[model samples]
Target: MKLKGIHHVSAITGTAAGNVDFYTKVLGMRLVKKTVNQDDTSVYHLFYGDERGNPGTELTFFEFPNAWRSRPGTSSISSVSLRVPGDAALNYWHHRFVQYEVDHDDITERAGRLTLAFRDPEGQRLMLVSDEHDTGIAGGKPWVKADVPAEYGIVGLGPVQLTVSRAERTERVLTQLMGYTKKGQYASAIAGQPDIVVYETGEGGSGTEIHLEERSDLPQERQGIGAVHHVAFRVDDEAELRAWIDRVGAAGLAHSGFVDRFYFKSLYFREASGILFELATDGPGFDTDESLDALGESLALPPFLEPHRARIEAGLRPIGTGSPS
Candidate 1:
């Protein structure tokens, strides 16, 4: 079974309220799920996506209140890209970022596509890639009620960049163990470095790519706020995910097998370079527990966590009211 494109990318955020404001109010993605981190029930896990929280569209965060800013280096998920409709959409977002005082670079080309690089208030590295010439895996429809016009709204996730010290080791895992095909290479933004390699999985396109940058120049990253925790790739269903679990095991890689994350099933593993990767199913999505109109209005808990809802709610500071103090 071939792995689909990206499922979601989970990152760290210092404050749930501010994260909510930036992603929802500024970026205009729908706050599709307000929940607690399953592994650590006390903290908030917020998910932003297209209207229905489709598989490739989700961008999630695990809140660690007052966390330190991340120290960027090698062996990290360096940058996360969001897909926009066209070149005109890139121009629209450039003006929007300026108006909102968002820190951003001028629109530039990367891998034959126009892109706009920027950071969140907490310095999360992000790029908006234009899909004007894309013809592979399709992007999701933007949330209709978002402040940004639908035509220019962020649709889904694009290529995720992995910065690692040992690119060959990670490349082996991707091509040999994980079934990603080496697509091509592109020039690195950093001067005098080797070209960044590109890999793609099922239905190759922007959404299915992993841009790998090999750097001998930086130390290991210390993850805190604004750093990506892991990136997950999409699986068609539970059966396909189960097959993948077996495949990962056959490769002798240590993994968390058959994790039933109520919204989806998952298998987590790290490549040779220590970057976290997850294979996640696409079904039993966000709307399974909540109706479409009421998503993210209140905290959601899986069936197992329902018993401790009161205790969990007591620990979290309220979000969406205003900025956290």
Candidate 2:
């Protein structure tokens, strides 16, 4: 099956409010949806992306706190790198982060792209690349700076890098099944990073890039409250996704049967490398439950979770509501 691009990258979050504040206020992404976790009713699932909250532009979070901290090793790829249009815009991000007292690194490079490395409040390793794709993902509150143009601001999430302890299982699934080609192995002294395996859909990885982080320095990260829960790749529809479900099962990897996720249909499995991977069907989209303009204002629950909304809302820890703070 020829894979399209990414649907969204899903990660773990601690609190509803704190997750909202960081994505909206700090990164300038919009809170497109505020919902509860389907598997676990008590926690929230937050989505942050561009104005339309389109596929390939989304970065979702599963709010589950008291999660164990992980080391920066190969058992998973933990960093989520967004993008800026140019070096000047990247410089702006570095300084802007200082306002929040967040530490960041100077500009660096990886897999043929300029990048800035840093950590979030929960130590989720993140980076921002100065790479632009041809599709022209639009609709973010552009970062306004004297030195940077609105268009040159963060274009969207460039790639969510996963550091896995082993590469074989995830590698086969990415190349053979998910349609990612082997780009190359990348090691960057500039970024102070370990050697990594690179994979992506189609050629040149113009849309979203996936890096297999195999750092000998660290071990497999434990997934808990602050760890990235799962990374989702996009599929055109059930027809396209079904092909994947068959392959995953054929490969002898037990996977969840296709499950409807409202905005998309989903299937989950742990790749041989130990990182959790999800396949999400695109569309029915962010507009499914709320109007295009009024996303994230109230709690949204899946049909199954709908019956227990009152109890779930009461159970979650409060998160920042609108904008930062």
Candidate 3:
């Protein structure tokens, strides 16, 4: 029972509308699903991804209208990475960021790949990694209708960075429990700190990597706007996910066992360092309720929530899909 690469990364946003604009308009990702947080049923849970909202391509956000800006520190999903076509794509994005006034850094190499680091208006940390040398799990196709050219559009998720106070504890959970192999380590961007270690699972590549950064100089992160909620890795289906639930339970880790998310089944558990990790299925995808042609154009709910659509819609402020006007 091996885990696939990243399924999706979910983060917190304060304004659903602005989140929509930045991710869809600026990043050129398709707003693949417009849904409410199933647990809450009040605020928005927006999903953005490549053309069809494929498994590894998804990046989601939960809207908490009044959430305070996040405090950057250890014990957090510090940085999220997006995959682009190649080095040239990074140059395209750098120029585009300038045109759109997006906060970003000059293109630089990280872990032997060209990357452009940037943040959303809300200060959600992100980097676009070049897939030029990538050869593991393949990336997703770009949305055909996106304003950004297909060659230069963001493709799928890359290695996610986890900053923790106790790296060895998290490393044990990753290697001993989760079956990730320690690939290598890189010099941390911060001086006087230990090197950030790299870990990978199924079909090792940028998409399948986790860059673990150990930072003792910072405080524990408080979840608020611009903070990551959880990072999910892909499992093939429900049967595999159930097997994983059993494995996690055997390890004595507390977990949310076998949740039916409608689109995909999931098993959630927090690792030793307090970072939430979810094992999610790759199918019964975004097209389950909505058609490929009209995805994210309207609000979607699971069958159970369909009965409360009116009440749910009433509580949400409209965050129009498609290109921003």
How much does each candidate deviate from the true structure in C-alpha RMSD? 1.7, 3.6, 1.9
Model 3 regions lying over 4 Å from their true place = 320-325
After superposing candidate 1, which stretches have Cα over 4 Å from the reference? Answer: 322-325
**Backbone steric clashes in candidate 3, count:** 0
lDDT tens digits, residues 1-325, model 2? Answer: 6665666777776666776767677777777888877778777788887666777778888876766665455556578877666666777788888888876888776776778898778777778877533333332344343133576555566777776655676677787767788767777453655577777674335355687765555655666655676788777888877888998898888899798988888889888787778888877788888897787777777677777767786777666544221
Q: Candidate 2: misplaced stretches above 4 Å?
A: 132-149, 190-194, 203-206, 321-325
User: Which residue pairs collide, candidate 3?
Assistant: none
Cα lDDT of candidate 3 equals 0.93
**Candidate lDDT (C-alpha), each:** 0.93, 0.71, 0.93
TM-score of each: 0.98, 0.88, 0.98
Q: In candidate 1, what residue range of length 10 has the lowest lDDT sum?
A: 316-325
Clash-forming residue pairs, model 1: none
**lDDT tens digits, residues 249-303, model 3?**
9999999989999999999999999999999999999999999999998888999
Tens-digit lDDT track of model 1 for 219-287 = 999999989999999999998889998999999999998999999999999999999999999989999
Residue 122 accuracy (lDDT) in model 3: 93
